[model samples]
Target: RARSRGRRCSVTGTPLLLCCYLAYLALGTSVFQALESSAARDSKEGSKSDNWTSLLNYTCLDRQALDRLIRDIIQRYKSGVIFLSNTTSMGRWELAGSFFFSISTITTIGYGNLSPQTMGARLFCIFFALLGIPLNLVLLNRLGRLMLFWVQRWALWLGGAQKNQARARWYAGSFALFSGLLLFFLLPPILFSSMEGWSYEEGFYYSFITLSTVGFGDYVIGMDPGRRYPVWYKNLVSMWILFGMAWLALIINLVISLLESSIVLCPCSRRNPCRT
Candidate 1:
């Protein structure tokens, strides 16, 4: 009975976590839009030479020191020691909303809607992913199992038969295959073909190229000339890519666990060793 209750808690917790993430994304979008507008207003009112874009010059610090600092910050975020603290006064609830942003970026979601604006920040991100990628994989593996276990528990709690870990692993695999198909075959063509005026094959290829983080930028979304929708539409596309990548990593982890559990040794080889 206790196990059943625990399962229910886990199932409920997953969506609650996702909801909290979406709320954070919304807050970030608002804050960034406000900041950009304020900067634009300031630029227009000030002297022509005093452009807001010029404020980005890293003259105060030499290039070498700036590079070192960026590397340090990247490492800190990767180790989970640093978090993104919002500068604007959006209150504590909004500040908490930024945590989802931190988690996604550190995991290399690279939503592109929100990104490191400064050269230092971008350089740090380069090295941050170098160290964080493997560590992220390790954490993902553990989380996948925990997620599946909870899902199984929730099912049993609802009076369904509990699926064995092996069976759960298979289901996860099947879901991953389905996700890949939708992503690599269906979604890109349907969404991008009309916008890019490319064939369905080209659209499908573009989807894989983006989700894989190749970022060739040759066929990036919203790069199409005169594409409609405000900045918010671009942000949504970025979030979708991030979510898809997260799901891909989870599925890969499940496949690994399944393979690990399926090892076997022949009984004849063990019992007739003396005959050899």
Candidate 2:
């Protein structure tokens, strides 16, 4: 009974943890939106102030007068003076933005494009990552097993190896290798390049670097100055990063699993060659 309970908990752990993460994500989105919106408004007001200040210079007003006015306006908004709003609430820290940050933290990607500016947020991130990393590891392993199970089942049916365990394993492993390469590595570059207007080489390079978690912070999506993307579009990119990390984890674990099982000869057998 205890073993059965253990199995049940293990099976339920992934979804339960996922639900909590999503709930936390929802709360973060609401709070950050309010914070970012206020910041943007203040920034817009600051720019209007700056433009007015510039007019003083054109009219040859006293240098001291321009300096005093600018200082007073900046001191009023405080840190909003630095946010530099793009006239849109398209902050680098929105719902999808926070979601991406959460995913990157859990996956150990650490893109560093966006980070917590406040001390409280930084401390919270530290604790969140401490717990979230282990949960992410467990979830990735479970996902790998689940996906492998279905892939192997398909392979067995296709190869007519339903009754043959060894043949099924071989066929499934081979098919999985091919499919994993196509789905994770090859197709993504092409798809990303088309959607983000990146060169094919740049797309492939970004995909490789991101999945490997090197996170150089060179290329980013939806950051075009001339073009603004929809909210759903940004969210979709975050979803892609999450799923791509899962697939990468699955492939790495699958390879490790294979290596561990590959050594067919036991230590006892190796020492008793005369028995063979």
Worst 10 residues of 2 by lDDT: 267-276
**Cα RMSD (Å) per model?**
18.8, 14.9
1-276 in candidate 2: lDDT tens per residue?
545644554454546556767998999999999999999989879866886677675867676787787688776445434345562333356766677778888878877666777899899999999999999888877777787789877876866746777777788887777877777678877867766788878988888788777777677666555666777766766666666676787766668666433323112223332111
What local lDDT does model 2 show for residue 209?
Answer: 82
List the global CA lDDT of all models. 0.55, 0.70
**Global Cα lDDT for candidate 2:** 0.70
Off by over 4 Å in 1: 1-176, 183-185, 230-232, 254-276
Candidate 1 residue-wise lDDT, 150-264, digit = tens: 6556544443344365665556556556865686458757766665577888777666666655544355454333445345545556555655555556665567566323322
In model 1, the clashing pairs are none
In model 2, pairs of residues that clash are none
The prediction achieving the highest lDDT against the true structure is 2
